[model samples]
Target: MRPLPPEALPVIVAARRTAIGTAGHAFKEVTADRLAAPVIQVVARDVACLGVPIDDVVLGNCMGPGGNLARVSALGAGLGEAVPGATVDRQCGSGLAAILMAGQAVASEEMELVIAGGAESASTAPLRAHRESPDTPYERAPFTPAGHPDPDMGAAAEALAAARGVERERQDDYAGASNAKAVAAREAGRFAAEIVEVGGRTEDQRPRLMRPASLSRLPAAFVPGGSVTAGNSSPVSDGAAVVALTSERLRAGAGLPGLRLRGGAVVGCDPALPGWGPVPAVRRLLGRTGVSMEQIAAVEIVEAFAAQTLAVTDALGLDPLGADRERVCADGGALALGHPWGATGAVVVTRLFTRLVRSGAPPGTLGLATAAVGGGLGVAALFEVV
Candidate 1:
């Protein structure tokens, strides 16, 4: 890839995330803003040496109180009344989408510095009811119109598994490996640097040693007599993650080591098969950026469901069970780390920052972060260590 002008280049200087907590468990009492404030504060403090004022705070949120979550979080972090905030909602892809928006602002020379990421508190998301039927509550809003098929995420994952010929054994094995990897990484303190302690919890709430044998014994969770199971799916969780992005000029002045935002793409697909979104999104991103999958030193794809994850890897010609798997989710994924919806996208990017930048990888080492959205959308971003 060719070099971009310093003023128009966007680089991520710092990233931080609160420890993930299982919904209805560790973070049941916390609100979304509270979950995100500490992370934003830490990320902002980390980049204070750059001597650039944060122009805006952009956050992604799927479910929460109706007002602007980004503003609420920014204020909660004590950023004062001067800095402004915006929110993005793309279902599961919200976090990455917000980051892409921030990068665009910097790349377009519209802003010099921005705080961008996502936060979610499934435990405290507000209930909903249409105005016409005030007494009746709905679990979620429609992803498509009346004529289009809009399946629940779990059902869609099950259908995807059946259509893609992903076997139950493979899903269970993949999930088991993810858990094992996460446990090992935690024991080795691989996640210590990226995680910010929250609410007296110093470690992620999920991730256990789940062997394939034990996983195989679990029954189907979505469809009767089907392969998808709770054991192989990401749990609804609460957490927040944020990254500080600034122009390359500012980064150079500060002598900071960071990840340069190369390019990104967002694409839509059939609502019924939302999990397949990552395939085309990634393809378009690589084609647009003139980068190939072989060049990416690390890849992070949100693991919403084992079946969905397998389908995506298979379609992309990635070997989830082979040596290539090491380049993907090296420390495990949402299956082991827990999926905090809007926050998972930023979480993946944070993982990439840790893998490529914090680990002292060579400059220009490329990495990719992609996620399948809940409402027929996919988001992908490419980065290079600088």
Candidate 2:
């Protein structure tokens, strides 16, 4: 694919997300469509404020009903039957991939305006039963094919930690800091700009006050002698996020803050080391855009596990420890927010949208949103505050 000039890329006009709910708890009764509908409505309402017609709605999903979730969410959100929608499933990378697809469509002039994001409701996801074994039930299907290693997500994190030499103390410290940052952000009302109310809850449900000393005492969750722990890993969650994409001309006409989609990339790696998936994806994105890490002001890398988060940051030459890690999630990440599968990727972009546009950052500041998928895939996108 030919690289388009930065000016030719799509611009984000609006971004919003529902407050993430704790799986099987705060959102136990909420379906995926129910969780996503309100955010889509708000995002569409924001686009209507700009007087631009929505051309499409693309959403990402994992464990939700198998049909077109985008269509269900759109109709539920009152987008009207005239609007068509589609859903993408790339595991956890689904949300970022959907946004990237929308950007490409707009940049190619195939679409004038698009709404792209991801949604999930772990609390309400139905049990699965394969047709071959109708009476038997399963939690999740295999991500890799036969003959390939397909470790559970938790097991992969533990293996990555052991392979990378990430210490348990380091993982605990990261988790504790994540909670602190998220708590601080919530207390400061920093999340208000992007988070919309859902189920009468306006704040993420996972983040809590956790001391490092106590976090260190938690037992390992994956392997008996391993470092990955439930406390240091992202909890199952429920939520949705949506962002409006439009051409540069429409953005100027709307007179709204714009964030340009400079570049994006998706790549596949070994299924055994899925956590490192983001490394190649980000590298490809930076290579295509000619944007270096120093040029990027903020980053939102999904915190599926402290071990994997540390490994990715170390691989990318970013600070993965102490206060410096704030540059990555600034407000917080999945570790503190909650991981609603597909929605986490879109939530990360919403975080960047808040940081670069709503927060009054200087013009031309760069931000990154990236995620590693369950099936050995990594997706990444680069944006600039306009």
Which stretches of model 1 miss by more than 4 angstroms?
1-7
Alpha-carbon TM-score of each model against the true structure: 0.97, 0.98
Please give, for residues 138-202, the per-residue lDDT of candidate 2 as tens digits: 87978998999899999999888988888998888888888888999999999998988887988
Q: Write the per-residue lDDT of candidate 1 for residues 117-232, one digit (tens) a residue.
A: 99999999988888899899977988888999899999999989999999999999899989888999899998999998789987898999996778989999999999999999
Q: Model 1, residue 207: displacement in angstroms?
A: 0.4
- Candidate 1 — what's its lDDT? 0.92
Evaluate model 2: give its TM-score: 0.98
The residue pairs found clashing in candidate 2 are none
* Candidate 2 ranges with C-alpha deviation above 4 Å: none
For candidate 1, the 10 contiguous residues with the lowest summed lDDT are: 1-10
RMSD of 1: 1.6
